[model samples]
Target: MTVLVPGIEGRSACTEERLLIVGLGLIGGSLAAALRSSGFNGQIVACDPNADEVALGKEMGLIDSGGTELAELLENVSMAVLAVPVLAMESVMKTLAGSLSAAAPNVVITDVGSTKATVRECAEAVFGCVPSNMVLGHPIAGSEKSGVSAANPSLYLNHKVILTPEPDVLLDALVRVKTLWQACGAEVLQMSVERHDQVLARTSHLPHLLAFSLVDTLARQDERLDIFRYAAGGFRDFTRIAGSDPVMWRDIFIANRDAVLSSLDDFEAGLARLRQAIECGDSDALIATFDRASHARHYFDTLLNKTSYQAEYHMQPHGKVTYRVRPGGQAQGRLRVPGDKSMSHRSIMLGALAEGVTEVKGFLEGEDSLATLQAFREMGVAIEGPHQGRVTIHGVGMHGLKPPAGPLYVGNSGTAMRLFAGLLAGQAFDSELTGDESLTKRPMGRVADPLRLMGVAIDTAEGGRPPLKIHGGAALKGIDYDMPMASAQVKSCLLLAGMYAEGETRVREPAPTRDHTERMLNGFGYPVSREGDTCWLQGGGKLTAGTIDVPSDISSATFFLVAAAITPGADITLEHVGINPTRIGVINILTLMGADLTLENEREVGGEPVADIRIRYAPLNGIDIPVEQVPLAIDEFPALFIAAANARGTTRLRGAEELRVKESDRIQAMADGLATLGVEHTVVEDGIDIIGNGNDQVPSYGGGRIDSLGDHRIAMAFAIAALRAGDDIIIEDCANVATSFPDFVALVQRIGMSINVGGDNV
Candidate 1:
């Protein structure tokens, strides 16, 4: 016991500890080389049946010492890494089970096997049960090359290493194993053995099998020589893994057999369907598959990069998007923001519940809107063509929706979540609605309490926050309820559930909210009536499909409107924006503040008012904003606050308690951001009073770093605020901007804003 292995004479090895890597091959040798490069002070050694490979590892200076006998190499080892092939793990675990007793008392054993279940089973069989020191692991990095000579130190750099440790595993052992991989420059993560096997079998094992199969299938043809000679980059790239050591791949496939077979079955079914499409000449089918995959690939890229719609849904930590706007840029061009987000969400929901195909134009392809679309697709609806702001939905009729496989993720849309809660309440299957962190914190009690009164069973977090679990098959009866506040989401929730209720449902708002749901419901042949403050719709009514043309969002255009309003001679025109009376609070407030704003080309499209707003810069004199206008322009206050900062006198706002519950507390978020930019503003309980430093000749405010509180409106508001700032304005936590205006920065830059948008995902 306590054997001392010899190393190269000149190298000083640490006697206090040792790290032994079994099977001196590419993976094991790379681990040693990376440790050596990372300046690991412990003695590095290895064990392999191949004597030549052991000698070569020492000669390459990858290991201080190595030997052919694992038993001889075990003494003084603080940790043992088994990098052997999958099928060979049983015998290796047997050797370890017998020999590990001679090593350090707290010695931990981990493996770099491709499949975890088999390895774990092998350990249990050998050690009578899995030892507390065992931390099952797999490094999601490797090469086609084999043996010790192909060792590359940078192989695992930035790659992921997953450790599948059981709950009964020792904490110290798990931490040490995680530390080892981290030291080798791998991003270490933890998961269960079952999940590891399932994921790896599909992502890694299945791909390799296909690569080998594809290459072999093509190589067997008579034109194989010509095929090989004419191969393109894609062919070579796809088949590169076929060049990997055959025996190793054989074991991986055998070890991860069940999950791989399941994945292969799914792949085969899809491939057969595609083959049938080719034979039948179905262009629509072809386009659907190709288009879905094309967008999905881009969507997945955005998910990884943390840039677009899926990013908010994923909420990854590596990237935080930020915006830096240089002072004083012209706001001089004609622009149109994306389609109204409220309408976009309603289109998808009603379309899915309608009886026939519904065609939609000008769909907002932002994260929040897409979350609505994807949720319908999850519930077994056939949807197509969100390409170029067009969507065709093959509706599944009311009461026809299949239950979603799991909870629906609504990115950052409180609108979608609330609306879904009402719609799902009458379904025959239970469902849940979930959202991102920002959406989760906002009040769902406003929607849940009303839906519950309609005889639906639902549950929310401690403060009535998401994720909302709605138990289906409830006998809903409509109720006449007056809302505490004017909220479009709450009203829409009750109205939607009313579709399945037994009698008439009436909702009275304290003030008006966006009426897209009501307008679109009637447009779809579902009768809804409004009398005074109450809107009523009877239950047991049907929704028939209709074409919808969504107008541009005024909420998004407010930022540009405010930019032009604050800067002298900065005349800008926003084209075809929705001027829905209920949503024009920003326009009303700005006009009352004395900005020379006019509407041109006013017309009605699909029952919603649309107009081109041309605002010419004129000196703004701030006034007391009326209480009646607060609900109409609730979303635009952040941008209006910037305009207030540049007005001639003080602007006082009141009766805006609703602003306290937006994605961020609009009152406080704008106030804090304004304070950073050296603007004078006083925060009251429900509203704010901003003192203006209006000047056509000089900057109205001095810029500084401002946190957007991860609110999209706050981010875009400050981005435009830079138009009147004396210095550069840097806005942080701006990624959620994708949820509303995915192209805000690009559109602004096109209209002459000097802004640099950069961050982890941007």
Candidate 2:
């Protein structure tokens, strides 16, 4: 028996074609809401098994009518949309098929599932219909959250809707689905179900699976309890997807088992090769692999909207004091580094240069990075962050950044400021750049002076402070700039400005900096030449649209490396980490300190080197840190400090004055904090010397209090130090850890480290 739920009686006559949507979760409710908002005058009835969800959808007017029973609702609908779990789709389709057979004018069916082939097959078997009328559709839209409560009407606006229709499917039915999707402000694309699954397995499914598996494994480990104490921005991002709906992912994994399995196998193979290379200490193999990966990331950056994507952070506290290094412990399972941060930043920036709206998945949306996006918005970039760290950048073209009416505020990101300075220096309009307190204190002279030499006028406070005012519209000429410091930011700035210079721009560094800028420029159809330690870029090169696959960041992989190196009997594997020569100094330094590190599965990702590293905790001996490695391991020193403190001999670090200008006075902060823990360490103007004896003999400070100084790195560093302390360590003003790693505490706790909030113990 069929029952009809009448439309609003007097408001408007109900169109005979009604669409019934099941599951009033974010995607389901959003579909209904978008349909109505997009001028669909047709009736939209929605149903959810949960009574409260249906009630809320109805109350919120997101649906014309809502209910808990699918059979009752299916009776009157002309078409049905299944927006539930992939595993649940078969049963729901079966119910719809039965109801459609009971009525006349058989209902057209469609589904919004992430994986297509399985869903299409399931639909065919369950509905007993030629697959044409049952369209397997994925809106490629969502957030990290779930439930109807999180639904919003604008979810699909200008997003992609991929349709996988079988050969026997009705063309008319496909057109209707496409039209409906278009009405909801989405562009439609057609692909074979198999291809869709394969591509997404690498681009989407694998990343999520890695994040979940990593967190799950950590949570089940005895060592996980201590992760919260030392986790930083990288771990938070790599494991963020762990917080997603477990049932949903479990279903996705089951449905796309074969493809997911294949992808994992490929990843495993790649990781294994890297492990072999590291074990043999093959520098050539290591450098080649890293170079390839670095190049690929740079190429991928040009296709992304750099301004829209932001970095994220997490912080946690642990009760345990004193870090222990034990040999042969169970290894942390292999982890693919988090989605590339450098690529994430460049994706949003370059995506903004695209002709149409560029949709991006795997974009990081952490707080400190979001500040960069906001700054871009202030500069006239049209960018939006809709649930799940995803972003859409409406590009304005390569030379389209409009001069900001006021100062552009970049918060706590040295990467953003330095790169943007180069881009802005070549622009035609004047702009002022500012930042949060931490950012303001960072050194800008390295980048500023070079741009000034290129005819760009930049005015800063004493010592090239923040609130920098750039006077643009000047005719610039390239210069043969010799880099005094091995700083990537400075080098990148000059190269970025060179893009608009009058002649070839040459930059020579005594030691190499990260070559992301050079590799990316080449990928963008620019002629960028690298000879020894010098890189040259010419002014006139056209950048075209291309697909990019970003490799994992090694900087982000350092935490796991440290974790495995310092935790006794622990072995950990990190997969697909970018081992660019400029960034591999950390690995080199740690290796010199007697850490047992192995690289495996060496391969190229978009021209950069990538591999999996397997590390085992071993008896470590400290050594003198070379001046050349300082710039290479600048961002990694705090962790290095922790490692040094736990090693067997004196560790001397010199030629690292750059630390004084970071988020906090990193060197000073680390020195003071170490002193508080009763560790003997000397702080020089340019470096620090730590004396270690491979024993946890240091007594705790009576107060058990440590200050973060509002620096994320400092906070995370001290927390790791707490592992080796005699008593509970209380880190005060530790909130800034959210700038990079927000899930630090939870991930660590899951592994077995006892961490608590607002207390002296744990």
Candidate 3:
């Protein structure tokens, strides 16, 4: 018994194949509209019990032909999309099985059901087993309006569509389903049926259930009209989903009963804990809960923005990003860079180990600092905020850290990996530290060897590289160690481990390095003393909670500082900048070169000094960078090279073999980039000599493409190099700029720089 309603008498065939969409509601009609908008080279048709809906589909051009019977729509259908309600899937599949027996044996079948396990069960029941041609998917997007009249072609744009294809499903069927979503401009993903259900129950279903319950409860009250009238925007926004179709939601809830109940149970338990805290006036406990949630949201937002891939699920990879810059733009403005990266890292690490809640302001929300924050959260510390550079950490106290679920992955941060080694070695549970590709190749022997001397059983990759596995439960006794090299990271690692060791731990450096760790330790009520060439701390002292105001990172400020220093008539002031004595080598080097640099409003905050740095264009003569200043300005050397390139004479740098071990071989990386720009430079194993042409009226160098090899500093260094270039400069692999300065492009643009950033990530 078949009936066909033909209305395609005047239509031109799009292709030999056809697509049939069953159930012409919002989901079905939207799919048809999206396909038609994409100019799909195939016929589209639909089926619905309502004849009016079928008429509407034809008039709207969503479908060329339609019928009221499922049996009539099986004519040459290459693919069938069943967009039925969750509870109605069973009856529709039975009809499909009875009708599609021999009509289209090779036709691909898919469903847009909100609940997968139930729809999958229906398919299995009707076909005696789940069909290999069937794919189940759910779109995580929609509008408040429903029906064919409200079909939106852009509903799936910039949203996610998750497909749950069984392992034994046909490859061709899955491909067709994937293609359909991709054509609609969706970011498609795949996962198991059980996982999809579990995630949706907590994230989507539970929230909707709460909204419905809350709305119903308020509506039944005696003062319902007043309550509704006085409700704020937050309440209305949260409860908006309660207006969805009641019958459909009821069926979805029934189908997903187990997961929904489990999620509700967890939510209720948390609510009970909050209730208890309120009744008992436990301000600390309440702050701990609220702060953790607020900061975690901010942290995840950062992850999503830096993403060019599956960032919503926290699975973004460090892929290729490039920056293109045009020659010559004025660097004139008052800018405040991101917080000091070194202090930002220490804030999270020390905050987690302190005794009480720690309040932090001006935390850097960059990739490196975020990696450090995530590491502490993994160890079970409750941290909150970073909403506008403010964070609250609920410290777990000394000797209170739990074991992390897996290896700590510190992306593109050698400082994080090396410092984590010492901090983790003191834990009661064993731990392993790991990092991205760039960090895996850097030397870790300096920190590992020194930590081992204090009775830490450490295992490392060949020649002392990560992944470093530090064995815990060892009897750690402090020792006086003399370091062969002066590295702030190495120094910080040993100092952090000293807190867990027995007796006094003394570290003597051959030269001075940034002492933020010692200074921060003292600020936290743990005593650390420094002599002329040595610093020592007594082991086994506890850290107390304290407030920290992180100043602007001088490393990031150096780019703009150099920009103003080299360009004629350019004046810029950087606000609230960190002027740590040990870390001002860049300023010292620039001052020595006679750049017009000024430090204004000098003061101290927390344990660090802050100032407003003003720098203007001045004639410069290059001098041999002092060997003693090598350790002080190690990171700033890359940008200083650009300053060297514009100076009046040759600028020489030596005794900086440490540059070879940075994010890249910064020494050779800078040399290569300089060579690409036609700037004269001589490279050696340790350092380089660059000849500067100090004629402000003409270009110092000609620009060409330079590969940064994913080093943030190197990429940023050459970006400012365009200010003095004769042509456009295209710097490749600049994505790591987010690791340090997330707003480098926008901030530079705001201050009148001709830079364009392009990358292949979300």
Could you give candidate 3's per-residue lDDT for residues 273-301 as a string of tens digits? 89999999977668666754654565556
What are the models' TM-scores? 0.91, 0.55, 0.82
User: What is the alpha-carbon lDDT of model 1 when measured against the actual structure?
Assistant: 0.86
Which lDDT values do the candidates have, in the order given?
0.86, 0.72, 0.86
Pairs that clash in candidate 1: none
Judge candidate 2 against the unseen true structure and give its global Cα lDDT, from 0 to 1: 0.72
Candidate 1: Cα lDDT at 46: 93
Error of 1 at 733 (Å): 2.2
Which residues of candidate 3, in runs, are more than 4 Å off? Answer: 1-17, 305-339, 356-396, 399-486, 501-512, 529-539, 547-552, 564-581, 591-628, 652-665, 684-686, 703-712, 727-762
| Better model by lDDT: candidate 2 vs candidate 3 | 3
RMSD of candidates 1 onward, in order: 4.2, 20.5, 6.1
- What ordering of candidates by TM-score runs from best to worst? 1, 3, 2
Count: clashes, candidate 1: 0
Candidate order by decreasing lDDT? 1, 3, 2
**Tens-place lDDT digits, model 1, residues 1-762:** 122232222113222347989999999999998888877888888999999999999899998888988888888788889999989999988787777765555567889998899998898789877887788999999999999999999999999999999788776677677777777889989898899888888788888999999999999999999999999999999889889999998898888889999989988987998899899996545655665565556554654555655453334323587788899888898988899999999998999899988999999988888878777776777788687899998777898898876888787898899899999988989999988778889888988898889999999998999999999988999999999988888899999999999999999998888898899998999999999999999999999998999999999999989988988878899999999999999999999988899999999998899999999898999899999999999889989988999999999999998889889898998999899989898999999999999988898889889989999999999999888889988999987888898778789998888887777323
Q: Which stretches of candidate 1 lie over 4 Å from their true place?
A: 1-17, 221-236, 265-292, 300-307, 310-318, 759-762
Better of 1 and 3 by TM-score: 1
